[model samples]
Target: MTLQTVILAAGMGSRLGRSLPKPLTELSDGRTIMRQQHDNIFAAFGDDAKITTVVGYRAETIVEAFPAADYVYNERYDQTNTSKSLLRALAATGKAGVLWMNGDVVFDPRILGRAIALIERDQSFVTVNTAKVSDEEVKYTVDAAGHIDELSKTVSNGIGEAVGINYVSARDKKAFMRQLARVGDQDYFERGLELAIREDGLRLAPMDISDLYAVEVDFAEDLERANLYV
Candidate 1:
């Protein structure tokens, strides 16, 4: 099956204290987040990569930086959150089996390859890192069978933090979108995934990446750590 990768890039990145959109921020190696992501995805999927990005908050700059990507604009991005931005991008494509990623995350290509491998094994799951999870990180809980039971920042004493990357299986796409529409504008996409998992039996799992390095660039310090990982 063809997989469409929709990156949610509409956030303002106020926490990072940067004027540039989070996705446009450059790493120490001089390559921007968008370029790194594009290159990684391209390397993972090659010519079959169908990448689409949702742009807002300096949308033109992201477009100019990654012109080859199919673009979807979220005009209400200032009021809405990543959940709305993600749904808008997915709605535009109308395709099943989507690969989702947060715009601010930087990781090795092996992470994407591993995610795709899990999807091919008929599992829809999010990548998790067990290295260290801060209080601000989004965490999840997995049952004895490895199925995710809950996902939230308040998920204390659970598994590691979420990597903000996931696969939505074709079987769950319809119900997933429906539940996502019910989420408030000021919510992350994980909220909808939780709903899909609990209400519609979406079979969402957690794939651990404790040995791998992946950084969600929420602060200047996180960016520095990500640079070292590269």
Candidate 2:
């Protein structure tokens, strides 16, 4: 099956203090964060990967940079959040399961290799870094069955940090889409996942990639750390 990959790039990223879309921010390796992501997808999936970017908050810039990519525009980008942007992409894509990531993350390419089996098995999952759990980042807790029970920035005593990369199996796509639609405008996509797990019994496994480098560039310091891995 051809892998469908989406990049959530609609956020204004005001915290990063960049005029350009956060995904377009340059890394030390000369590739923009999104560019690195694009390369990683292609490297891991080869020609079997289809890429679609959800663009807003300077959508033109991201579109112009990657003319080959498919795009879905988020008209209420400034007013909405990741849940809406991700909803738009999911609605626009085909029936295949999707692998998606936040636009600003710079991660080790090997992480994708690690996820291939899960994708092929049609397992829904979130990539996590068990080595660090920061308050500002999205955190997760597992249920008795070891499935993701809680997911959000405010999750206390979380086992790890969700690294902004995730996959939704085709089997769970419609259920997840419904949950996403029910979320509040400003709620992150994690809220939708939480609802899906609670209301629909969606089992989301947490894939630990703590041994690999994955940084969501939300600030100058984050960019510095991501650059170190680039």
Candidate 3:
């Protein structure tokens, strides 16, 4: 089966204080954040990788940067959040499972390598960093069976932070999309995951990548830290 990847790049990223889209911000190694993501996806999946970027908040800039990627525009990007952007991409793709990440994440390429087995098994999962669980970041809790039970920034007693990388299996895609549509406009995509788990019995797994570097560049300090591994 071909590998499908989606990059959620619709946010304005106001905290980073960047004029350009956050994904276009330059990393220490000279590659833009999205460029590194593109390269990493290709490096892991080779020619089988099919990338679709959900664009808004200056969509033209991202389109111009990677004309090769399939594009899905979020018309309400300014009013909505990652939930809507992710819904758009999931709706646009075919029946295959999709691997997606926040566009601003700067991650080690090997992280994708670690997820290959789960992807191959058609498992739905979220990559997590147990080393740090900031209150502001999305966090997760597991069920009795060790599957993801709760997911959101507000989750209490969260085991770790969701690193913004995730996969929706073909089996669970329809249910997840439905939940995404049901969530509030301003909610993050994790809200949809939470609803899916509660309403549809979606068994989302948490894949730990704490040993590898995966930073979501939300602020200038985050960019500085992400650059350390670049």
Candidate 4:
């Protein structure tokens, strides 16, 4: 499979109150967060996997860190959210599908390998964590048939938290992008996925990743928790 990676790394980590861009922040293992994602995805899929990173805040710094990754700059990154960032990155991909992730996520390389294997089997899906969820986490619910019925942070009765790791297959790419482009800058990429599901019959079932560790770094506590996991 041609596993292309599109990583959204544009946001300034203002919530963390850090001067450095979030992706440039060093983790407990001494690898910068973006470097870790880049290294691990390549490790999981081999060097043949094309890596594309969408950058804005301190984009030069990220480019310096991983020159090998194809760069897509989100000029309106400050005003836009994941939906726009992802759309811009996807355009640069020129592929029918891609393995997408947030730049701040810290996880086991095997998770990437597992996600790819799952996509190879099913062709499309999103990673989910069924064991644990918090009010702050982006949650999702799968129907009795195991197709994702709803996905958003406001889903109070969710069955799992979305890990922000997804496989967009060639078959679903056009509809996915159409929904993504229909959204406003304030909306999340999840909104686009939801639109795709409702209007385009996109079925992004939940692939359990509860057996693996994956944490998105958004605050100091999250950073601490991620370090401990690593």
Stretches of model 3 off by over 4 angstroms after superposition = none
Clashing pairs in 3: none
Residue 126 CA error for candidate 4 (Å)? 1.2
- Root mean square deviation (Cα) for candidate 3: 0.8
Error of 3 at 68 (Å): 0.4
Write down the lDDT of every candidate, Cα atoms only.
Answer: 0.86, 0.95, 0.94, 0.86
**Residue 134 local lDDT, model 3:** 90
Residue range with the least summed lDDT across 10 consecutive positions in model 2: 42-51
By lDDT, the better pick of 3 and 4 is 3
**TM-score winner, 3 or 4:** 3
Worst window of 10 by summed lDDT in candidate 1: 114-123
Each model's TM-score?
Answer: 0.96, 0.98, 0.98, 0.96
Better of 1 and 3 by TM-score: 3
Runs of candidate 2 exceeding 4 Å displacement: none
TM-score of 1: 0.96
Q: Put down candidate 2 lDDT per residue, 13-118, tens digits, no spaces.
A: 9999999999999999899999999999999999678999999899999999999999999999999999999999999997779999999999999999999999
Model 3: number of backbone collisions: 0
- Per-residue lDDT tens digits for candidate 1, residues 1-230, read 35689888988989999998998888888999878898888888776788999988999989888888899999998999988898888788775688889999998878887777777876788889877777898998887677888888888796689988888877788888888799999888889989998899888888888788888998899999999977
The alpha-carbon deviation from the true structure for residue 15 of candidate 1, after best TM-score superposition, in angstroms, is 1.6
Error of 3 at 182 (Å): 0.6
**Alpha carbon lDDT at 90, candidate 2:** 98
User: Model 1 segments beyond 4 Å from truth?
Assistant: none
